[model samples]
Target: MAAIATDTHPYGRVSRLFHWGMAALFAWQFVTVGARVLLPDGALDDFLWPTHKPLGALLMLLVVLRLVWALVDRTRRPPSLNLAAHLGHLALYALMVAVPLVALMRQYGSGRAFSPFGIPLMSGFEGEIEWMTAIGGIFHGLLGWVLLALVVGHVGMAILHRRLSDENVLARMAPHAGQSR
Candidate 1:
């Protein structure tokens, strides 16, 4: 497919879309969180909680999409790196998927049969275990900071590789030529 990055590899359109769209969603995560953390909890809390819950659930959906895309799409592989860097990528994906899921699970497992967005998941293992909520809750918020750090590192590396080293690291997953800025 001409949409592919090159002959042997390239991220699929849906993969690219999910990646970028999730970036916007993740940005909302940061904003929603800052709104909660910085602002005093009150009437605003209830309003923001609903918004945050849905945004988080959307993140879970996007992460699931990315996982599926990764499984199907043969993305262009980056140049060789040390074991640590490779492991870091693995860790990044793990955190990316788990972070949103843990948060969603905490909410649903804590008791919300349907997604706050209105789409009913209809499959949460609710009432299976009370500890799920406590653990998920702690990890959800804690790992959010970890996810943020990992993302920052991921972006920093991409920029460094692309701009400083003049590599095509980012263009691999970016929109097709002539489509984006």
Candidate 2:
């Protein structure tokens, strides 16, 4: 086995920046969505929901950029755990890109008002796809759970690699200097 220490298989600076920034946005989304569903109306919550739609749009764009990066620089995955693990990772990436899209589609199809940075979208198609939006809402919920499960497994594997095995799993993702390991 190789030592995937804090310095091993260094992700490019763009990759690292996008990786962490996207992660923070994703966490924010989970909180935003959860609050929208679970909390009653309030000034704070009302203000927060608007952020969700735009942030989701930003997430979709970032997904495209991340895909391009992944293709151009096929990351040196810290040695495969197994075929299942690889497949699981593939699935997780697929859904992260897919779920938000369905939600965006729902916004368009349901005639719901949304703005990506206050620029309205889908106005031309309002009242055009009510049924599609209805279906999208259901699909969005399903995708959310799927994303959650995949994240749980990923986090668990990272913990196992660090605490049980001798691997430096978490460190591999921490901030690093240029080259001195």
Candidate 3:
């Protein structure tokens, strides 16, 4: 049981859970965004569009939890491959927190109620706050795209580490079936 939970050059179970779970959710986010950009008011976009805000809220919650878990388990986690990896991850975390926060600000500023997953987060206001909405409108989509690019770079670097440096970085987060440590 200790072995199952402890990191031995590989990520622990909880860390891997957060990593992979967030990866899937992020993938869905990208798909939804892609539909919005490429398909617009088409059927696919229409179907996926409604999920965008709610899922963003969920991702924000997960990211906050993941951040806290990472801090608590810092001593038990695998080390960054290098300075670049460390900075890249830091940027990813920053954007993960920033993107949804800006959106929430915009939602609130727009004088609209927001109830993601049916939990009332922001109540409707009588009038809009221009500055908050403007800031959110300007940065939210831009930062989201930047984060996606960084994620692509992150995955590429992991594969490059395996092929070029013989470092099985992905294995730390995604070990094979029946494999431990």
Candidate 4:
């Protein structure tokens, strides 16, 4: 159907799929982090902590695919709500890529094998690399928190734009809904 592939109207099926699917995954990722933080060394932490890395790896892969899809669909997609929205999206993309990348670098530096979803990503080494681990240690949690804040802001702005300006910002991506463009 035409609606399945054109964001100039409503967002295309593929784009919506990527957006909402990633949103759910990101939500789960944050839940895992929250559990780890709030219930440290407890049963909840034990259960959620293990899912974090594997889910993060999965998210990394999906983000890459989504970015490529975005580029390919650039002309077909609706324009951003404003300059701030454009820049906010860019920041989201950057942090999405950077967070997992640094975590993987740290994994490599730890001289440990990483096999997310049972696929061998890295082979364990004999010794650790200090600088890589240091960078990961310093930035991973900090940037993750920052990313969370940005995500919250993003959601808030979407709602605010819709409520205060009657922009229908949220509807643009929803099924059979309004298009700002």
Candidate 5:
């Protein structure tokens, strides 16, 4: 059998790079969140918590890029293995976009300045918008936790697919050369 081209096989290099890169970032984000929740007021929480918003903002950008790339490469990229996988991916994308956006909304509504990576995204104002802040305060963290759960389920399903199915789904996303489908 011939080896599938990167664009036509599992995922292109760019796709994999986005996937793994965002995975690492999400891991860091979770660590920061966990520390904030479990070790509040401690040095670890203080250290990691500060990165949460900035990192979330970064993830939001990356996810948008990834979505665009996926669309551009859709014809060449590997097909979804099943309906479940397709729906799961859609949910992931939805949550990924929503989590950061709501947080940003809250930040803006709070009338607080936010500069992620030293770029001024929001300027502080005198009065807070109660509804925007309330919506974000309610959903941001809750949706974030939901996203994390979905991620865990995603990984679990991938493992199950690899172990039980005839096809090795992992090969599509795994870092390897000359993969075939």
Candidate 6:
């Protein structure tokens, strides 16, 4: 049998790495957020919640890199099986970018210095910008939850696609050694 090209096979190693790596990070992000919502000021919440901002910053960076990689690999990556799959992926990308951008705007506008991993991205200033902070306050958490919902839907659809149709959508992004395309 001829070896399958990445363009026609399941996702290449780089694409799978990006997919699963981001999935793991997102799972951690959700845990932190969940701890905050459920435990409030308790120990777990206190510890995990502090990590949220830094992790969000990291996720923002990763998502940007992933987006560029996806575009570069567009022709080589496995095609979306349907219109819903295409649109769902787009929504995920939109929310991923928006959530962090809004938070960073709020952080800057609050006149609070933010140094994720001590890089000193934003410096403190006097007085808050009401509009920017307001935008982040109103939309950040709300859209995050919306993104979570979409992620759930995305996973559900992937599983459903495998069970109901001929496509094994999950395998495209999952790691399976020595498996044929």
Instruction: Give stretches of model 6 more than 4 Å off.
Output: 1-8, 175-181
Clashing residue pairs found in predicted model 3: none
Q: Which ten residues in a row have the lowest lDDT in candidate 1?
A: 1-10
Give the C-alpha miss distance for residue 79 in model 5, angstroms.
0.4
Better of 2 and 4 by lDDT: 4
**Model 5 global lDDT (CA atoms, 0 to 1):** 0.87
lDDT of 4: 0.84
Task: Tell how far residue 38 is off in model 3, in angstroms.
Answer: 0.7
lDDT of 4 at 92: 94
The lDDT of each candidate is 0.69, 0.74, 0.87, 0.84, 0.87, 0.84
Off by over 4 Å in 2: 1-7, 75-79, 175-181
For model 2, residues 144-179, the per-residue Cα lDDT tens digits are 878978887887986676556646455555544312
Deviation from native of the Cα of residue 103 in model 6, angstroms: 0.7
Residues 97-130 of candidate 1: C-alpha lDDT, one tens digit per residue: 8887787667666665654567777555536556
The TM-score, computed over Cα atoms with residue i paired to residue i, of candidate 2 is 0.82
Q: Report the C-alpha lDDT of model 4 over 1-181, residue by residue, as the tens digit.
A: 1222222366678998998898899898899999988889999889889999998999999999999999999997888867989999999999999999899989999999999989999999899999999999999888899889999999998766655664666766784454332
**Stretches of candidate 3 exceeding 4 Å from the true structure:** 1-8, 177-181
TM-score of each: 0.76, 0.82, 0.92, 0.91, 0.92, 0.91
lDDT of 2: 0.74
lDDT of 3 by residue, 69-138 (tens): 9999999888786898899999999999999999999999999999999999999979999999999999
The residue-by-residue lDDT of candidate 5 on 1-181, one tens digit each, is 3433322367778999999999999999999999989999999998899899999999989999999999998897888878989899999999999999999999999999999999998889999999999999999999999999999999998766656655566777883533434
